[model samples]
Target chain A: MIKSKLPKAFLLCVFTLSIFIVPSLFAAGTQEDSSGNPYAGKELSILVSAGWMDSRYDETIARFEETYNVSVDLQTVPADQYGDILQTRLLTGECADVFWIQSNPFAIESVIVDYEDFCIDFSGSAWESVVPEARLLSCKVGDSLYGLQLWHNSPEYVMVYNKSMFTEMGLEIPTTYAELKDVSAALYAQGITPWFIPGADGWQHQLAFFQIGGIYEANHPGLYEGLNNNTATFKDNQTMLKVLSQMKELSDLGYLGEDWIGSNSTNMANMFGDRKIAMAMANSSYIQQIKDETGTTDEFGLFLLPLADNSFFPTNPAGPTMFGFKGTENEDLVRLFFDFVCETESLQEILDNSPAYTNIHVNDDAVQQHWLAEEKAFVDSITPDQMVTPVLQTGTKYTNDYWMDFGADMMSYFIGRIDANDVLGRMDANRAKSAKIAQDPAW
Target chain B: MNKRTVYPVWFVILPLVFYVVFFLMPSIMGIFYSFTDWNVRNRGDLSFVGFQNYIDIFTSEENYASGIYNTLKFTIVSNIVKLIPALFLAMLLQRGLRGKNVYRTILYLPAILPFLIIGLIFKSVLNYQDGILNVGLELVHLGFLKQKWLSDPEVVWKTIYMVDAWRGIGYVMTIFLAGLNAIPDSFYEASEIDGANFFHKFIHITLPMLSGTIMINLVFGITYGLKVFDIIYVLTNGGPGRTTEVLTTYVYKLYSSGQYGMAVALNTILFVITMAAGVLIVRGMSRKEVEL
Candidate 1:
């Protein structure tokens, strides 16, 4: 009886030990197999414009490469030539694994017309939820997601002025076009450039006209709808013509810098610091840059671009956004790269590295944002009515595609080569061309 | 006949095949596509649109006509500016001078440097405010003479011609030097014995001797100026408002905006112009050669 009891106890102990040891062995094996990164040894390439990524993505991209044991090939092209390069690459089926576009709500369709053919559908991606609903329109066509827009929420293309200088000059921020002209005249009389429009940049000077879209829409209700539906045209719009005329007046008066058409924004901050120019159109974040680069102690403030008696905020939600290429052989690696960048750690790295940006406009609460106090105050000061609609370029379909052309036309008008109405008419013709290409029924 | 002197027809086959595959095929395909409603929207499915693209090119309010006009203007002016100076420089350098090789090297340096680097340097130098050129003028009390070299439409084309000449004169001079070198010294010696001056010799002997080289340079320069992009693109980007816009820039804009058919149509028009110009130039030069 004693021997039988001993055997029973031994058997029970052995069975219990087996239950723990076997599961532990299987769990260790599974962990080892699953933890092996699938993206290891793969390479990912990204094509982007210079300022779009800059050094802001270096840390995040480095960490991504380290984590996955891979390499990232970043091809940066000049901003002016980026559109042409991107178009050629996409058409030739030689696009990189990742590509970027200056995306707006209508850009994915209007700019990259064949998004389905070129971009990978990230519809069900885990990172899809990380993008905010407003930005999703830029990232998606219908229900299919194709881009990830990690942009700043700073007030872009607003009037950034030296507050201290304005105070010293006994000048108040101009709220109407007439006051703007008065202030400009006063500044010009004093031999100081009132506004430093960098027309040589080709894209910067157009903000005066397009950033006042709220004023245009307020004057003509359903203007955006009409423009989109082809019931309206940019031609013969009295407000726009007035705005163009005002711009031409500013150019003619030489208040828009000495040879503004030849001036670029390279030394704009220095000009602000030296007090050579009182104000210029720039992002709210540029105030910090001016302080940092110029080491100026002067207080800077943001205001609405006063043109054509306009008092409206530039309600623009547009920025450079990235997409995975559909033709990439390493789709899994591309997906992993996207997922890696959207992670909270990577988001923090990106935000920290971005000196030009104040905050990443994402839905992630864990991601720490560095919103500047002045930028915050500027946003808070905007009235509800001021934020009427998106800027003209982003609001209308196919409008932003011809931004450079429109700027050129505006310059032509300024130089007395083309009339204001011809400038507006040219815009109408451009929109029609784009609409025809887009096959928009409205046109 | 020797086998080397009487080559087989297969000798031309390989090069012809490559030419067709690489050049002729793409050009033909491009011409075909120009007639279609090909765009970014119609990727993988292009539809024929007859002469609509051409019609748009001509009738559109985009001032493509101005672009064509600018192209012709640039071709003519750029060649004149470049060829004349290059000829003079070549003649000067061909004669005995101190450190002629060094001068040649110095002159050729701009041609060797990439257009992008030259553009970047000159853009800074030509800037309206704080640029070296304007500042230098001010230092010398010649500030009144300083004009907006790049911004004023009146001065902008002249500025472009200056920059183009700077980069291109050396290459043209080098070619001219080669032509000059090929001329026997005996012609100049005989002309010297005839009491011929520099102008007389240049007209009678140098001009006739270098006709082939001149024709070559003209063909090269005209094609380059017709397809002028990098210099203008880098300097003014067809601006102070489209006063500087040429056909290539317009084509680039069209292509960038995803209007493939229109872009191709514009290029086809350019191709036609280039070919016509080439044929006329070569035919006239050949006729001149026959008369000589």
Candidate 2:
């Protein structure tokens, strides 16, 4: 009886241990999702920005899952932390099957230096036709297409203001830098913040100064080309200093907001909703976001930033691009997913779901464009002359690489740690460092 | 015929292998990489840039030097705040305090809470505009004392130190309590016979006996303070014009910006500082033990 009992006890112990150990051993292999689909045998993961991919993609993803007999694992990280996370995963050789990049012509070579190593060469894929020629440059490295960037040609990073609020506060749509200062004072007098720049947002605040690349380049011709060649410097530019000081003047005067340094973009929509601030710099899509998320009844409109007496529009072609991981075991499935997203039905569904977006920057004939009425009105208000200049970050060489440092420099300037010229000098130094590291011919 | 004996020093072979593989090798490699230009652009093309990265760290006119100063400031201040208060609390709890276990548990709870949760909660509580801390101060008719907690460069470090002490004091106090409990009742009895007063016994017996524990806490606290990241990140992210920027934050920034070589160099410096401090602490404690 004792021998029999011992055998049974040992068996029970072995059985219990297996239950705990086996699941963990297989944990990494079993990636699941809440996505509804009949085919759930294989798994696919996509990395995308927070606001870029609309809800219409859900139906498309579900359809792809059903047709391809795979489960799509959508891992959407917030924009602020996206770069760090994506870089870590890519470098560690554990990248998602289908990853993303806010790629431009230079980005593929500069940012993803090992595109051929990690990216699946999608050179002759049928989906290549749907991407616009200008945007096609963003997705290709050498002669091979390695990414697909299908984004809108809408006005981006433009100054969006509450028109009703401006009228109520007796403020004008500032046409020049001087007029902007006067208008800010007028709004501040009425207990309204003139502009809401979320400086604490690691990425957004610097857009005010950097987005006007046209004026900077136009004012000093060959500046962009010179910076790329390492011959030009951002240091001690009187125009940039003027812009920084203007920003500082506004910040110091409490026209940007009472605690602009501590504020984040998370409360921006709410600020617009609550009428706490008169205006902010945002993409055209964001006006829709402000209305939908905050349910604000305030009428909002867009205007060119009154910087440098310049009325240039930012024609940024760069948007989030999808690339396949060459290291992925399921390369076929990844290719299929990209192809599937390019289909007419899927593209239409994506557009329908994207209420914020007016249109997708694609050449697909079947996909119906859905530009918002407000965006159309805003575009109509602008002249053709104002709609041509490319925004600064994407337009210049090695500029985006120094964004965080520039933001920090701006903060330093605001708090009086560094002068306006010093801030510009730091930007030049950062650009030089990046240029050196990149070994760009311009440097 | 000679009698031969063999001992199993092989008993430590597995653990030693683990220590070398996980700790020693990576540490050595980190230092090695720090000297090379090993960034994202040069992933497959590493070149030796001996002392260049370090030179930039030391000589660059940027805010890197201020980070070193801030890091040192935090380490010293945090240790003093945690160690002194912890020692006193440990003594109090050892003195037949009511609900001693409950107090100990309460004190230790914050130590176990994750830094992410603690940071988020404290950030909200410390907000100047609508935070509970300011509201409470206002209710008490002390609105004058209410100030921008995280936003103000002058008060941000103090706020971090206070939050850190609040979370860490309990853990340190627990260690001291263990040291206190280990002491024999006979020591106190003999002291009483000699008519030693409270301070007399405390100075001669308690403190001397707690030296080992104190040394251990100091080492742990110093290393932790040196590598502090989450609290500063979640509260202010080394902001308000880099007032609270530390070595770790700089390293993090470099890593995030894909400056892997510079990032590794900063961490390598931290590692050296930590190891040096650790050796000094252990040697000092051992010498004191021999003297005692």
Candidate 3:
């Protein structure tokens, strides 16, 4: 009886010890973590825009979990609805542990002026090295770095054509605005819509005119700066009016497809697959999506849009960047997660998983790039003359703020409710509205 | 029993408390927020800016005015479009029609299906060039009738009404059926004995009896129409140049774009419209009750 009682007493003591010591053990264990995080069992939630990041990052996530013993709940909202959902959550004060914003220099200040309220300051993070100076301008506001944009350098928002289609028709890629018109006419004569602008997309159609901002700025000189300062206006800008007219001409001439205004990007792949449309404005990676989805036989090629005799690239450096919510319960965990993502192995895994991406712009040398031969070949084919200035929408103030309005005005122009100059005037008025809201001196 | 009679006012207190907390408080708070400069950038640094947002809403050239107009139009048109056809279908199914249960089930299926699924399915079916609707029309040599159902501003409203009716009519019919069942069979028999024809029976007995159901449908339809966003968003996105813009869609745009103050103001306006409509409908129903 005494022996059994002794074992029971020992067992009781052990239970009591466990009750007292288990939490202390955990606390002590996390105290040793070097990344300034002591919440090992905690979770970090990151909300992202869909289609911006591919599934290849799953490996990196798993590895990060293994290394840190913390879970990362990466929720990617659908691209179209993301903005609204983010805003609603933010307003309701139920935002996730971390969140992403598509920011530029002006965007962080203009769109998310309350970034300091929500942002976890990363002014001196080691990961800042990977971003180029031009790109850094978008990630920073004042002396603080609030966003990390590791976007690929690609030929963006330019006219992508079926190279095989051009070759089969014994035609060369058009080099001038008049040549584009001639090519379009020839394609139509052969029973194909030469340019398939999915106006119903409400986002894609505007790129044709907006991405050719180099020509407009070159002609007007200080046009964007003037607009930013409120001294210049989008209305009566000669080059912009010409570009808008040219777009209208394309729509009117049946080159932009019969029902271009009503068409969505959902069917563009099928249209290309079936050889109904010869070209569209898209990113270099989109060719892969088209080929994979439709199994199209036509090989694709990129060309600069011939608006205003322009030869500039749309260097769209904008992408989702993570920021720590100030109100998060596990702020330490969030910081650790960011540090883990910047590590070489995790970054490499992310790039490796992205089959659709050619490269991930990062400062770490260990992360390998997966640039395809075709992409390289396309880059090689571009002459120095064609590599003009970057488009000015992103760098300037209060311009990207009116993206949706400009799109609507362009649609109005297409539908004949407004003229080309009126479309320009609307942009100016919308800018003035934004400038007033911003309390900018330019207005 | 007389000795045991008590006021029992405590029974009302719980529900009253719940209503004040959940419904009344939030509504009052929403109205208060609308009057202030309560935006995302301010981070709850609210200051009263009375009627500025309201003024901006009305004077704004962007889709706000059209959104209000579309909301009113949809409420009127959708109710008429759904309620009348549903009443007739309810009448037909009440008769000795063969396979009525199967028909009812088939009709009601769309009503119970998720709105997201309906929006997705209809978007495909209504595609301009190769959607099944257009293709079917072409196959039957009715190609001329085919239009860009979701894209053409002229016909987009019609398509929205059609899709909404397809989803809502069966539910309305079911309600009408319940009303039809509640009406005494003896009233119809007495009408028949009085030498009343089918139209005469329908006018004298059916019409007066089904007024409750019609009122219910109007209330439901109006509320639904006022709050419509998902179907239009999935189908047209207030596009072909905001031609299909409505009040809720406009509110959604503002909210998503981080204009919380403006969004709240829009919602307050919608709430006022819905509340006023609801009160009027209830009052009308009550007056009809007294008359009956």
Give the candidate number with the greatest TM-score. Answer: 1
DockQ of 2: 0.49
lDDT of 1 by residue, A149-191 (tens): 9988889889999899889889999999899999899888888
Clashes of 1: 0
* Alpha-carbon interface RMSD for all candidates, in angstroms: 1.3, 2.0, 2.3
- Per-residue lDDT tens digits for candidate 3, residues A291-363, read 8778877798888888777776665566556677777887777777777777777777777676556677777
Residue B120, model 3: Cα distance from true site in angstroms? 2.2
C-alpha displacement of A146 in model 2, angstroms?
A: 1.8
Model 2 per-residue lDDT tens digits across residues A400-440: 76666778778878888888887777777777667667787
Error of 2 at A151 (Å): 2.4
TM-score of each: 0.92, 0.90, 0.87
List model 3 lDDT by residue over B15-79, tens digit each.
99999999999989888888887655564477899988898899765648778899999999999
lDDT of 1: 0.89
Off by over 4 Å in 1: A1-37, B1-4
The regions of model 2 sitting more than 4 angstroms off are A6-40, A52-59, A66-69, B1-7, B127-145, B186-201
